[model samples]
Target: MNAPRKLWLWHVPLILLSAIMLLPLWWMVVAAFDPMHALIGGHLTLWPVTWNLKNFVAAWRSQPFGRYYVNSIATTIGIVTLQILTSSLAAYALAFLTFRGKRIIWGMTLLAMMIPVQAIFIPDYLILSQLNWINTYQALILPFAASAFGIFWLHQAFRNVPRALVEAMMMDGASPLTILWQLILPNTRPAVITLAVLNTVFHYGYLFWPLLVTNTAAYRVLPLGLSYFVAQQSGFMQWNLMMAAVLMTVLPMMVLFALAQRYLRAGVMHYGIRG
Candidate 1:
């Protein structure tokens, strides 16, 4: 076959995967509009028999989702900011500095990355409880302040930075911190951006810890509030309202994903260009 035909064939799997990914979102939009009666057949659909805003109204009024939104956004910002700071500093040290126990520290970081998050939940909870941070923003934000994966990812990215450039900066009187902030990070834009995006999505969607700590709506995040919203309906619950709530929580992430994709697409770099 021709080059065009071969390229078209290569696009087939991607198109199929995209559709698979979109199917649930399509169903969600449909369910968010349809009446409760119509959704009881246990069949998934993209077509809405109704288009009333009742579900949205009910979902919003059913809980303090407004507060949940605030909590989610604040905690997400805090976690991402701290992760970037801690991960970058640790990664920078691991990449460039000659410190005592460097190899041991690197080994521990790798081990931390390899450990499952669930395994640490108990100890993490105990630490936060001892500090009396349960149900507070600190409970939500503090545990995720450092990410082993972020450190490892940035360490590898930092390693890929041209050594000659770092040496030149050093010779020109650049301090380690200065070199990290100015030279290292700028050149590794994609890696940093990817880490930020991943952390944002993960922390923003975090539910288990919020559920474990927060008992009141005052400190509730979106996911935890969503669970309460679902539980509010006793028997044959309003899936439409639940779908509405879910989509409401997901809308922020969808917007973020859209924004992030634009930058991701423009992330291609030439050899001499800063990413």
Candidate 2:
């Protein structure tokens, strides 16, 4: 009926939704430190009754998580870096350059985005197998280096850049690469950082492709490692240990988001306003 009441009505729903979403994360933190017998006995609480660090130690020692962490970090960084580079270049060309069949190319990119990766898995696997790239970093990283969504996102951001600025740079006899590196990239900093953050977050948790590609624990990434850890718990589920592994697997991405939140927010704002 009143403004404050209406505001409360909206805020109440959102607050409830937020709590619902965060419940699992809270459960994870609680379970990660709580003793296994307490967890199994339904003694779970919002706070840890008895804090134990053994779960973390056991989870870490149980598997080659150290190697898994290294592989995940390397593959994620490689994929994000290459995706940003290739996507930005393609976006710039599509947004700024005038060429024959440009529309067709753009259309194709959109079409590619429409097709899910699962649809092309067989072909991709065969190709990688032919190249003898399975069970290697190349298998993990190369297939995902080019992102259709990244190209589309950056294309929208690139379009927001003024044509006059590009023309002025060209008038100064700057090469296309120079113009892209200096003018376009600097102006699109927020978008670039946001894309990087998003890519990092997505690839950090990527499980399906890595599972399909690699067989051995040598090249196993975090997600696969977590799954393997779960599988090793044959008779009884080690809830506390599993939760510890999850927290460990998730911590880096959480830190990454915290560090990049500013840029990510700015980028979202920029895209929203520009659109």
Candidate 3:
């Protein structure tokens, strides 16, 4: 085959694969507007002859999606804020502080990462229940405030800070706390933002633990509220509304990731470079 023809042939399969991957999302956009057709129905509607905004409106009206949205935002933001604070402080200690049993403390922190989140669910539940936090926002945010992954990530980033820079700060009569807050933290902006964005994306879709912990719709996040569409009634199975709900739930984090793609890449690169 000629060069152009060979190139076309190679591109053909890629084009087909792209279409295959996008088919569901395309159908979702179509389905979100077509209220008459259910998502799993035999007759697939390639395009809606009539585009109506009712499905989106109805999905919100059917349940308090707005409240669920607010809850999700609050939980995600709260969790990220606390994680950044705690993880940065802890990572600073692990990276710079010299103290008794420091290695053992760091070892325990690493060990925490090895323990699967699911395994701790029962204990976490018991603790939250004892605190009467099962149906509260604290139940959603407090437990995840200190993330092992965030600590480890920041630890690596903090290591990249030159020792001379810290010493310079110290020689200038700056305290260790001042060095950490003023020098190290500012230099680690990319790593911090990357972890915050990653954590928000992760916790946004955290369904199992949230569902287990929060029973009331008042404190329910988007994932739990989206599931309500499945559990409530046969009519709610209409794919259009469900897809609309899914898009509504997913779009924020998707946009966030898209915007911060470079920072995330830089964080990973810095980790490798320092290692």
* TM-scores, one per candidate: 0.87, 0.92, 0.89
TM-score rank, highest first?
A: 2, 3, 1
Look at candidate 2 and tell me the lDDT of residue 145: 90
Model 2 accuracy (lDDT, Cα): 0.90
Q: What does the lDDT read for residue 270 in candidate 2?
A: 79
Between 1 and 3, whose lDDT is larger? Answer: 3
Q: What is each predicted model's overall lDDT from 0 to 1? A: 0.84, 0.90, 0.85
lDDT of 1 by residue, 185-224 (tens): 9998877887788778888898888888778889999988
Rank order (by lDDT, best first): 2, 3, 1
Q: Please report the TM-score between candidate 1 and the true structure.
A: 0.87
lDDT of 3 by residue, 1-275 (tens): 54664676788899999999999888878877776756446775888867888888988898899999999999999999999999998998899878899889888888998897798899899999999888999999999988887788899989989988988887899987799889998998888877887788889889988998998889999999999876776644567778878778877987898999899898757664542
lDDT of 3 at 68: 96
Error of 3 at 28 (Å): 1.7
